[model samples]
Target: MAGGMRNLDPVIAVDGCAVGGEFQGKARPEGKTWLEGKRWEAGALRFCANLSRCSGGRRLSSATNALAATSRNFRQATRLLGLDSKLEKSLLIPFREIKVECTIPKDDGTLASFVGFRVQHDNSRGPMKGGIRYHPEVDPDEVNALAQLMTWKTAVAAVPYGGAKGGIGCSPAPDMGTNSQTMAWILDEYSKFHGHSPAVVTGKPIDLGGSLGRDAATGRGVMYATEALLAEHGKSISGSTFVIQGFGNVGSWAAQLIHEKVAR
Candidate 1:
């Protein structure tokens, strides 16, 4: 809501979230956003980089109050880096925030409508990159925070991409969410506006240009980050006890990767 997200309506499916710089009504064409007022948790960047590992109980902090302790830290980081005011403001703004309404027919011949959002943060380094989240209780603010987090993360990590977050508020899915099929649908839907923009999305089936090792990409990243962080603390991943939250692709791979390291 802080980023003129009110201006984005849930009427059209989405003419926003342009890939490769090709959308007509680009939000704030000047590449400025009003998201500095939004707050992010200290570890929110880490939380967002990985796929949805901690699912169902833990939220990404829906409250904007202090944005959960990273507000001042964010500014302090900028100050520490001796960033100029204009650049600082630019860093704080998101590129675009989009909301759309999507409806599909259920197997029972009933129509199901769901609300979807895509918040695209800065892309100075490269294309905006993020993940899709599906949950009945998906929080738009959380997604916004995630988008903001992605910008900070990719920038800091030099990942050569910006941040963007998308989610659809929908029901449980053994049939709907959490698989390559879902990405296929998303690719098709997004392609309706932008022709053959496969790169607009990731995690699709390999036949559809999906990359190898993507399933383990998030988990592998978590492993590497943990190793780096622990190295600074004079600790190692060996003999560590871990408690996983969600056993999704990310969580499962994280567990496996960490275990492999620990065993080694």
Candidate 2:
């Protein structure tokens, strides 16, 4: 991440922790990863997680941390767009950061505690939307990095929602971890604070009014888009070489649809 900050102006300063911040009065020297004095203290600090390992062994926090990548990309984008300094800081900062303890009783009557995190980047578009992932390695820093990504992702998609991402640093039983059941639990808990609001989420079980074929909708949409683009060029997907990355839900579905069209 050394040259990652090369493109951005010196106005984007760094705090003691090396995170991005605003320069109060003096512009910090070039290539300085840390700052001192009240003039360079933190006023706003946030970055999208890089999540990819850099060339060197050095790390901001985690080995595969994401802030560096996200931050560098954002700075380059702001430079390209010629956005204002104030607006750039505003976009980098998140709207909210939340941490909570989730305790549950085990089958043997013992108790277990797992940490959870949710970072809401923005909601000015409409509602804050992101994924609620459950994994044992989930942590606050990673969650914060992901939230920043969600903000711009929604904007690029021209969606009406903002970016937000959540994750629990633990796993669940196989049955409860599936799509419908997980959504049902969320709906029930949310209803306790607000009301019976099924609209709060999507991908609920069909019994709970989840969208029909919701699981494969994204992949299907991708396939349709590809077909349309190919059609415009006087070609089709049939017998064409297609490079589909990842085997997740979206990729799998998109591949399936394209495969049906005899695409290679």
Candidate 3:
């Protein structure tokens, strides 16, 4: 319809009807407008917009729209810093977006395909650093948002690394059929182009060139952060009572460190 409308003369308003910019139950032509006296377009765009608004049952989660929030925060920071608009825009754009099809053979000798995405948000500071998450819900938008966050976080911490995030649409638990093997596959897959780059990704198993403190880094960070905050108030971890929710890898390590401090 759009192609046919192009190269045609301006569509005359039938019966001088004002263009109805909505669709009730079905789509129908309402009125038309001419673009540059050549292309004639109707109110279909508005109709589709309204239809989408009406059909949407629930609002999208802020997590799903993480990039939008990141942009807003970045814009506000840049505005307060009085940065140049051109530079601000340039910094906001991601350095690269990569999507690949990961096809792996299941135990049953059948091939299963999953979509993988990697977003490298920046490289001004140094090499990009991020994690490769394996979850069925992993998506490009979330990965992009995470990559941007890594860039900002590394810059704030004065770390000589940019930001990147990659993930595959697969489970993380071994019982559910995915685990460390997933990262190994991803590392091997990524190395195909980058050529044996271990630093290209973090959070790998110890056998895969992963650093010694990688697993405990987050918990250690929390410990130091808590210590700093307590020191500001002339208190220490041993003098405080803590309630840690969800004793996962990070939480468990943090609890152990704090307990040891109290024992000493």
Please tell me which predicted candidate would have the highest lDDT against the true structure. 2
lDDT per residue as tens, model 2, 1-264:
000001111111123233231222334576223422333233222121221221111223446556666777899999999999899988888888889998899999999998888888888887887776676777776667677887887798898988788877776534222455667777788889999888777778888878788777756766766666556545677876665434555557777988899976
**What's the true lDDT of residue 112 in model 3?**
93
Task: Tell me the spans in candidate 1 whose CA falls farther than 4 Å from its real position.
Answer: 1-72, 173-177
Query: How much lDDT does each candidate structure score?
Result: 0.58, 0.61, 0.59
Per-prediction RMSD in angstroms?
A: 13.3, 13.6, 19.1
**Sort by lDDT, best first: what order?**
2, 3, 1
Question: Of 1 and 3, which scores higher on TM-score?
Answer: 1
Full candidate order by TM-score, most accurate first: 1, 2, 3
lDDT against true structure, model 1: 0.58
lDDT (Cα, tens digit) per residue for candidate 3, span 1-264: 000000101111111221222211222365333322322232111111122232311224535475786688789999999999999999888999999997889999999999988888899999887766566877788778778878898999999988877767876553432234545665787789879866545556779876677556765766776666556545566755664543555556667876778822
TM-score top scorer: 1
The window of 10 residues in a row where model 1 has the poorest summed lDDT is 4-13
